[model samples]
Target: MRHVSGLLVLAATPIGDPRDAAPRLSEELARADVVAAEDTRRLRRLCTDLGVEPSGQIVSYHEHNEAAKTPELVARIAAGDRVVLVTDAGMPSVSDPGYRLVTACIDADLDLTCVPGPSAVLMALAVSGLPVDRFCFEGFPPRKAGERARTFAALATEPRTMVFFEAPHRIAETLTAMAEAFGPERRGAVCRELTKTYEEVKRGGLATLATWAADGVRGEITVVVAGAEPVVADLDTAVAQVLERVAGGERLKDASAAVAQASGLSRKVLYDAAVAARAT
Candidate 1:
């Protein structure tokens, strides 16, 4: 029997500027057997901007209907359709629709690929002036005030840069919550309208950013916050804590390593001190 070819293509759309759309995106959009879009209207506008008309069936695949539509799309792909998936902006499945379809395709053992393009998270982090060596993309903070506060507080000790998306209207309240939870002096950057004509990146302490957004900013917002500084631990204190844990049945080496990690001290120093104390 001749093998039938099938594939699922996830194409990333430009976040703000149409010019950032990838050339491969236009090619796939034009040649695919099925174009599943988060918003068919937005896809049409994008096609107009790219100057490429999709020569395939365009179907609506969004949050509201994805659960029901995924099976149909999977069946079509299983039968040799080249289905291209595109969200309203940025890559699909990154705080966007298409995750279900992708998982569905995986379960069916179908081939899949992606058309790379612009990402608001990367763009924001790059311009945020924070330490980008290590970072975390925290989609969107909780909307409710209490939940939001609790969430930020839990991440207060995070030692890697953090990135988040926020609605323009809620930016002020969100920033204020961040200020209270992560400390007003904690530095952060508010990137608005990235890659667009009115692009702006405001870098400063979290409190300052909160005050700036209090005046009511507009457009897409991406915030990047610097990581918490490592806690400086005293050698005597860390050794005592390790010894206490060891007294509670943990191995001396294991206790020392755990205490060193929590206190940001040297594991070797902690272990040696604990051993010395035990010997004495």
Candidate 2:
């Protein structure tokens, strides 16, 4: 039997500036056998703005109808159709639609590919003036005040630089909670309207940011906060805490990471100690 070929392409759209759209993106958009978009209207406007005319069927696939739509797209792909997926901005499946479709395609052994493009997370981190060597994209924080506070509090001790998306209306309240959870002196930057005419990056301590944004904040926002300062302790003490965390149902790796970050000990050293202790 001749081998069958089916492809699922994920194209990243520009977050703000249409000029940032990649050439490969344009090509894939123009050549796709079918295009699954989070918003069909937005996709058409994007095509018009980019001067590209897509020759494929454009189907709507968003949070609302994702569950029902995914299998349909997968069925078409299984029949040797080229399905292209794109979101309103940035890469799909990064806190967006396309995860279900991707999962479905993966399970069906379909070839999955992507057309790379701009990312607001990377752009904000690049200009945030925070350490970019090690960082985590946290998507969006919780909406409710209590949930949001707990969320920030849980990450209070996270040693990796953190990035989060927030609405303009909630920036002040979010920053205030961050001040309490991560500490008033924790350094951070608020990047707004990235890659647009009103683009701005405000960097300072959390308290300063809270005060500055007390009046109001506007536009799409991406906040980058510095990691927690390493906590110093004896090697033996760190190892003991790691064991305790593991006993409390944490994975050895996760416990080791937490202890290492807290004690300023080498993660490998603590991990090795843990292994040896377990063997003993």
Candidate 3:
């Protein structure tokens, strides 16, 4: 029989406006035997703001100490103490700490649940003008230009709306790179300071957003990018386009590879057809 570890409650704190705080969150904070906070000071401030004093022992649970804390937390839960995990904003483990400890609890067969509350990802998607029926949450864009560009390129064919967290200072550079990877005219929204006093949501084509962000952006940012439009697979048309490129002094090999890559066709077959067409 597996050991029955105590409950692990993953709680979501308000991203901005304190009124969004759910009653369940308050109850969990006050009732749990141990409270694991990414930032203990922030958690105290939150409790102060919400008028809910935590009765449990509050401990720091953030990235820096997460590795060392997980086993200890799991052990505490195994001893039958309910542990509540919270972050500065949003839920624990979404580009935040608590994921490692959650895994430990799962591995130990510990009881686990969430005190659901505000999430910046969902809030941004809800307000983003882009399609929301299907969407993906990418934690954050890479910092380096080349790495970030490659990351966007990998999602070039993704047809679901994409959400990404980003730093205020990096928004302009990131948007510019996204414009290049996803196309200048692709639609997206820059949701800033979500639910805060200075909240702003800017919707426009990638190019336009890039231009606007160049002047700079501030606040907690969530960027929603429209999925890449599905390419109509027409190999015959692709071959003709390749031939056109060839006519413009492009090598047959380069044109064939480009068309085949974009259309998911056979490069060798495209090259053969181009050769046959030239002979005719």
Candidate 4:
């Protein structure tokens, strides 16, 4: 590959097992003028395992500091520096700190490249046993109860398989909420500690998974939900759900809004569907 001048290299580190680290990653780490890592300590350990020491400056770049560090990283790259960005594991900026920096580089008109390696997203999606042809990653959901419910509700009718990252403590609650919003029988998978020694993947209906998670779980968790099955025009069902929400004290417009948002159908579409259902 031609050497990319002034490129922001987004390198992927091994999610686990140092041996999984790619040869190109080590080479880039050694050759780059600046290395922006999500966790500098982890990067140092990875370097030790790879038997390659970074000769250039290594700077901390993570969620808390990404906004502050983006411009500095962009400036270096624009100056024709080869800047490598890495996260604690997997690809940087995928639910990591690299997005801001990558966006900054693009906005600054700097070249960008990648040394792709392990990705939990693809790994889980591949093993998920769900349709992988089309999918979306909805990182972590809101931590608060109401917001999380609303978020999941918004995706209740999403037709594309959905992937999510959830902390161990909240996985059960998230699964429960997902079951309630997407339906208990919706097929899904919960992958924990992927690519690690104790890696485990539990696949089943949302309700079953929620039950298993109720006792508590641990390690990094990635949830893959099968997309919603296409629903035929059932004006009766639509009207019933709408009336139910409204009966629960939601205003007509608010209920319609919730249904529209969740189903990815326009409010006007659902409103018309609801009206037709009530007439029938």
The most accurate candidate by lDDT is: 1
Clashes per model (N, Cα, C within 3 A) = 0, 0, 0, 0
Deviation (Å) of 233 in candidate 3: 3.5
> Distance (Å) between predicted and true CA of 222, model 1?
0.8
TM for candidate 4 is 0.83
Q: Per-residue alpha-carbon lDDT of model 2 for 9-82, expressed as tens digits?
A: 99999999999999888899998999999999999999999999999898989999999999898888888889
Candidate 4: stretches off by over 4 Å: 1-4, 234-280
Candidates in order have lDDT scores of 0.93, 0.91, 0.90, 0.89
Worst 10 residues of 1 by lDDT: 1-10
- lDDT, candidate 3, equals 0.90
| lDDT per residue as tens, model 1, 89-177 | 99999999989989988888898999999999999999888999999989999999999999999899899999999999999999999
- The TM-score measured for candidate 3 stands at 0.85
Which pairs, if any, clash in model 4? none
Query: 1-280, model 4: which lDDT tens digit per residue?
Result: 3335688999999988888888999999999899998889999999999999999999998899888888888878777799999999888888887888877777777789899898888999999999999999999999999999999998988899999999999999999999999999999999999888999999999999999999999998899999998755454566678878978998878888877665556678777776676577
lDDT by residue for model 3 (140-225), tens: 98899889999999988788999999998999999999989999999999999998999999999999999999998989999999
Question: 64 in model 1: Cα distance from truth in Å?
Answer: 1.4
Error of 2 at 268 (Å): 9.8
**Candidate 2, run of 10 with poorest lDDT:** 1-10
The local lDDT score (0 to 100) that residue 268 gets in candidate 1 is 93
